[model samples]
Target: MNKFYTAQEVADKLKIKKTTVYELIKRGELSSSKIGKQLRVSEDQLSLYLNGAAKNSVSAQHHDYQPESSLLKRDYLLHSSGLIISGQASPALDLLLNQLPSTPGNLPVLQSHMNTYNGLYSLYFEKVHIACAAAAPEDVRSLVPGLSLTALLFCQYPMGFYVKKGNPRNIHDFPDLTRADIIFANREKGSSRRVLLDRTLKSSGISPESISGYRNELVSDYSTAAAVAGGQADVALGESYAVRSFPELTFLPLTQETLYLIMHSENLDTPGFQAVTETISSENFRRTLALQTGYDTTHTGEIFSI
Candidate 1:
């Protein structure tokens, strides 16, 4: 008979923690054999697994991992109580909280922001169950090794120059922002608005130094919109919904972008997480989001798993 290695031994060989190894077994993420009361993997089976890993078996691929119910029951212990959902400041997060079932009749929902990068790191630390971010397809690819991104919606919002509510500057599009007379406002680093501004400038072929008052950066979309509203800057890039509540600014339609919900893939099977996914697709929720803003919610809560 061939000698067999326990899960802990296999974990040591793989250089991962024993807890992760047990998690893999509980999740059915690793293969093994049951010999009476013992669970083990033969040396040959281990070598075969290593060889298959080199070739990247369909099931072994990072994107192909699926946790069965048996695994969920063993690993995910639900207490059926409160959970903290941390993300950026947005009405959508509020909408999600409102839709979740309050089992004890009333349980508070905690919301916070670490920006997108820090938010992803927070999730990796198990500090939050859900994280929200305006991630481009490329950003999604970069963030996926640690977080599994689910496409919540492609918000086709009017993202562009937030000018004073009038035809004073004649700022119609990206090019006009470079006019010698126009003073442009920008967003701070690690913000979604900042990323959009940089990309828009590159796409429009405008030199950063060429624009007047380019260094003037605001912290959030609300602040960016307010800068234009307060006449601090003639123009600034922002979303329509940000300034729609404020009558002082005008929003010009810009590019359509994707908004993603990033979370540990293990959260997908949790009851609270499942509730979030269900709420995003509900007809009532869709109607509320549509009525409040001109956001396109046609495919809200849709999953584009990679």
Candidate 2:
């Protein structure tokens, strides 16, 4: 005889909410059968779903596809010039990329959102034209040994904990993450925010094992915030921009970091590169950044220290 699991049982096994399980069923991603108005998943189906998910997660972690080769076909490449941008994801960055095609030169810009380290690595290998980072220049320089890189100051924003509304857990700083009762959500290993959080915890003499859900990793800031918002996590480290999307969550400011647009020194003279820099420095772009919350545009396009 085959065993069947209810939606709640599946949620418990997967460490997610029953509602999320129902949503998966509604979307037809999870195989389910209705039995007396209750949805149930068979043991074999559950195993199949989990195995497929694990395989996909492993695949995503192992490969970092180049933008032009992946998104642009041979026919499209013949008629258009490609400019690949890889780095941290932000609303400001999205807005700027969206406006690139309308710029005077009209180059086709493709965004490959990854962590700061991977972004820098891609830039070093000429895989991307621009790499955005939140780390300091000194740290970024250490990553690319033989290449001459230039960094342009993009914007500054507050980074901190995203917690439930009304200060429920009172999670204000890094140390609070170790509390016995708190469950934390973490970003992937290469993310800048995760790097800062781990360093702070190490200096404070806190073991990652002491924190519940320390091994639970999500891909993006919005997803991290959503996990917390959906009651799957107690707190997560992210920037102020993610808070705007989750009204049920509030941001506790911990520190501020500057965002920079990095590029190879040789690419500085290219028309595509020039177009990006010009668009970022334009009055219209500045106005757009100014209107966005949690971002400081005073030095939006300033070339800080190359």
Candidate 3:
């Protein structure tokens, strides 16, 4: 005799909400049989669905994804037996994910590195479970118009200029990048660092076009620093943590920024979501953050409504 699982049992096995399981069944992704007005999924059907979903996910990762295409990829992951975490990359968040205690279904956490704005957009659209962002509170509030969100302070870190070890250019402030001799490795548009750089340049009466390599875009803080260390640019704005990885570079503190984790209001009560929060609040995770350079975890795990 073959065993069958109820919708709720499938949810427990997949570590997802019962509603999500029903959505899968409704979409014809998961085959179900009805017996005496109750729906049940055969074990073999569950195995087939999981295998097909895995194959689709692997194929999607290799595609050249546009913004809309990326959203579709995120949706697929959200429906799979994994928690999708999208946002700015942080060692702290990575550590938290590694330390989270195993739950009933043991869902894996998938990290998606994206800019602050994109991360928030994913969360707003229900494409991701958690969004790690480093933008100002006001900016984040504007992204999710209709969705209710809960934001938590992940950590505070200093942002600054990553220059060559000797500081040959003597670049001291934001305006220095406007000097004819300087070449800047800039973050891509929509990134928090890029937004800050533009704002700072505007307030200082500096035209970005006047700065050499102003349009030279790099994706992450590490890549931005790598440009400078590799002698491709003079300076780049990035978090201090990046400096630790590139010994050939030196850091000059610019400003401190807070990184937050934003989630939908409804997910806070879910078992997986609660496990994530518990991990964030654990003493072990706190200790790990304390040991990491350039991070201040004093406010880690504190939730606020935005």
Candidate 4:
């Protein structure tokens, strides 16, 4: 007799949200049955899926990733899992991916994450070879903690608030969040924007609970910025380049944030790693990157030990 488990049970056993369980089923990654409009998974099917996933998992903590692995691991150099690059998907990054040499036959691919925090965490766990983040090295090291990774300077961009045109609410700084009339749409927890918000709120001695819409979370910069553009939100934290797509919204510069390519210190000298440095440091890369609004290429390919 096969025991059938509800979506919630599968989510619990897998340590994921219930919505994700149903999504997996929808994607045919996980098998399920509809017991009169209720989704159910059999133990055998779930077991099979877990076993297969573990064998393919780069790190169980991050999922839905392509099978490719790091730049050049000594153990699997021949059957190497290609280099995995993690970060928010951006034009510059996509260009970097295209410029990368077809190492082991064009195996490099970007493992898109929500933002810098997710990318940095993936770097810390050795899940990705090179990770990008819109976070300064010191900020990532001190405030977020965990990684002993090296930082490769990618570019610099302004970090700021996304507000409606003409700054209707007179929303100028982080303190504006404390105003009773302000409605905030926030980035997901752990994103650099979210990190900055939390850090600033704490330093200002303002209790998070005191702010209205403080708990309201938006999934990505695009979404959060869109909320402000559509008048659904009063303000959102974002890096300047990202909010450029929403022309209707106005960006109020707060500070500058540097984009960094993070990696394990031990992998610095690898040939594949060198290829990455070459691609980013090249004149063509910088020239095109500088063309993008709000990007500073002064230190585009510089590396630093973090």
If scored against the real structure, what TM-score would every candidate get? 0.66, 0.73, 0.74, 0.72
> Which candidate ranks first by lDDT, i.e. highest?
3
Error of 2 at 103 (Å): 1.6
lDDT of 1: 0.64
lDDT of 2 by residue, 1-306 (tens): 557898899999999999898766533345554343345676755775676577557757988444753422222112224565675557777777777767776565545556787777666655567788877877888876667777777788889999999979888877788898899989988788888888888999999998898898887899899999999999999998889888999999999888889988777768888888888889888888868764888888887445
Off by over 4 Å in 2: 1-80, 304-306
Model 1 stretches with alpha carbons more than 4 Å out:
1-82, 101-108, 124-126, 144-149, 154-156
For candidate 3, which ten residues in a row score worst on lDDT? 71-80
Candidate 1 versus truth, CA RMSD in Å, comes to 15.2
**What tens-digit string does per-residue lDDT give for candidate 4 at 68-102?**
43421122122223565666556677667766754
Query: What local distance difference test score does each model get?
Result: 0.64, 0.75, 0.77, 0.71
Candidate 1 residue lDDT tens string, 93-191: 656666665322323333434456655544555544566777675675575464565555524455666888884898887778778999988876666
lDDT of 3 by residue, 80-125 (tens): 4556677555687767666764434234554555677777876676
The root-mean-square deviation over C-alpha atoms between each candidate and the true structure, in angstroms, is 15.2, 12.3, 11.3, 10.2
